[model samples]
Target: MQLISLCSGSLAALGAVLFAYGNGLSKWGGLAVLLLGTAVLLLSLSLQRRQEKEVTRLHRQIMDFLAGKNKTPKFSVNDDLFAVLENSVVELESRLLLERENTRKSSKRNADFITDVSHQLKTPLAALKLYCEMDQARNLGAHSQKQLALIERMEHLIYSLLRLEKLRADVYELQFAKHDLSRLLEQVWEELKVLYPEKKFTIIGTAELRCDAYWLHEAVKNVIKNACEHTTAAGHIQVLLETSETVVTLSIEDDGGGIAETELPKLFQRFYRTAQTKASGGAGIGLAITKTIVEKHHGTIAAENTAHGLRIVMCFPILDGVLAAG
Candidate 1:
């Protein structure tokens, strides 16, 4: 617009100068040209102002529509370009909303199905366990004992699946509070000692943070238990706590040989097991549940190979006043 105005003004000035001083040009003709140039300049300025106003209004409408202040945008019928853009945006928004609704419904249905099936299986599983106990009382052979152990393993797997599903579906309620981190790890270690009596476990350092004690306990226990399983009978598992100004890190390192680099990334995937874990009777659900729990607390978990073995690091952000007071 400015360029057009400058060009028109320059033409008008040239014509006026010719009318005043040029001998070859007719005075009347130069005057007529000057008038025409001035008229063109004025007309271009008017059109430029109108176009700018229209563009401003269009920009505001598009912003409002995107911000959810307007469901439908209005535009002048003569604005072919802007009108086309508005229509395209509306169509894209509709498709996105529809897809979002479908995803929500599908997730709800899947969660409900899992919950129903898990509940239904519980009754039959309980009966099977009862029958196995009765057979044991009758002094069943080694075969019957193996069958009972399999049933117990199945029960454990079913419960782990239910927990993982609930976490994924965002249905699990976490109770967060400031708790002593050392005490929590000690509590978990106490219960695990009976199961891995030969494996040595140790907790070092102390700190406090806001977290869901029960779920965090489960998460820490799973990591330590996993470490115990992968290590030798006399292997040492260390739990170390370190806190900085903004982050709290809990690291669990085991003397067991670290997993392959390729398999580390998939360690937390549900039902994903490497040959070593599969041989240990791992259902591969524990670490998955632990990952979900840590995420729920707005934390992160990662596994890396250490010189001695594998290290699982869980880091949590220290919100204002949460760790400072502790």
Candidate 2:
């Protein structure tokens, strides 16, 4: 545009000079006319150049911000030639960015939900699959027997996944029931013995804890399962259930090497698994479910590296109805 304007003015100046000389007009008049045209051309060229540079800079800044690279304060354009376009582009970009962030949050939520649904459907499917794959014949063939055992293992995993899924869906899906907390621990330990015969899980301390019985059982079992998965054969896992006037503490620990300090904060996040357990087949929902269940029961859970290993500390609030005066 600027070049066009300059070229047109030069041509007009030449025409004016020729006209002045041919028609015998004053030469200074033609010169003044040419100078005025030249000044107008320069002004237009300068404005166009400024606009082009501003547009280029704005494009670069937007790109940088989108890629999370440049954080050089938001481009403020209260007034300018591209002000309207800038405002429009910025508003559009903000909406797009907000949408992207919302998309990420929604995706995570869907992933968690799908995981929960898949888990809920696993148990019955596992039981059915196991029953179908088993050899019912009086004399079972070796191959069929091996297949049956494999089916059983897979079925168990499916059930575990389902339970873990339910835990994630709602930690307190199972309502509280009046029972001896000690008894529930014993039952959970007995179940663990069958699941992990090679490990030694010792339960210590006494006193009844008030909690949602089934979900608490699931939380305890999830912790035990975590320990079993990470520990070697005959590895030591301990469970301590302690009760005071106001709070109940349940601690589970293992001799296995603790989690990385960086990953510690995310231990309770759904589908987040540690490097050590990645090789081992696990859905990675156990601890997350445990945390959910603990929270559902109005309890607090935390993790820390102990002298020998990792310790999970759980605290539950005791609920006692207010006393009624006579």
Candidate 3:
């Protein structure tokens, strides 16, 4: 455009000179300058249009590639003006492909490591468990009992880690079914009673929801176990279930020494143990596994300190056509 303007201005100057001189050469000289300037202007406009089209084409190619229409972009620069841009796009594509390959390899390595460790520890854990059972049969003394307890704790830790690893790697399948949420709670409560044999558990309400019965059972058991461990023998733990049009919520509240305010956010993180829980022989993986299971079922789990204790709530969204509780 600037070149075109400059040429037009030069033509005007030549015309002015022609009028001033009025020589015989003025007429032909002015006409020649005007024609040359017009040609330059037209050529410049044509080049600008072609440049615009090239840019539009390049942008479309990028969009197409991003939208997954093309795995490999077919781009060629016929003009020198776009040579730098074309090179940059090609370089960026190469780097992105390399990064994706690296990520895939890293993920595979992680999964392999978890699988190998789980397999390698199983035989030894089984043998230890068998030894503990035999020692219990023999009516072992206090030291033997302590050793058995330690062995049991170690086995629990190993199994919990394996479950967490499988969950992280998406290796386990969830069997979703229409299960009675109330019944599941009752079963878990019964199991907890048998496990603790000293704590009290209360059922407040009942509601039915669709979920993976076994996995959800595990999740709720973890929460109940947590409550039992945190509460005193006289303290009460309550299970409450509520259902709405779009969601089903199950809450476990206990009148125990509640968690510290700062620990609420970190409660669901794997291997995160508060100072108070360290002596409780908890590996800190139960809540993490529970969170992962809840999330896999398209639910959210959170913890809050109540006026007297702690409450853990898990809510799952109800899809269309699912049964609603009255």
TM-score on alpha carbons, each prediction:
0.65, 0.51, 0.61
Candidate 1 residues 65-86, lDDT tens each? 4444655444345556656765
lDDT of 2 at 118: 66
Off by over 4 Å in 1: 1-107, 140-142, 320-326
Question: Candidate 1: worst 10 consecutive residues by lDDT?
Answer: 317-326
Model-by-model lDDT, in order?
0.83, 0.71, 0.78
Who wins the TM-score comparison?
1
Clashes of 1: 0
lDDT of 2 by residue, 1-326 (tens): 76778775885687578557855465666666677777777777888798889889888767665544543335465786577777676777777668756865665565577567666766666775555555446444556666666666665555555555544444223445455767887899888788788888777887566556777788888887788878888889988878888988889899887888898888888778888768885656678878877876768999988787788899976653210000
**After superposition, which runs of candidate 3 have C-alpha atoms over 4 Å from their true positions?**
1-109, 123-145, 320-326
Clashing pairs in 1: none
lDDT of 3 by residue, 178-253 (tens): 7898889889887778767877788777787777788899999999999988888777899888888888999999
Clashing pairs in 2: 119-162
Error of 2 at 52 (Å): 76
Question: How are the candidates ranked when ordered by lDDT, highest leading?
Answer: 1, 3, 2
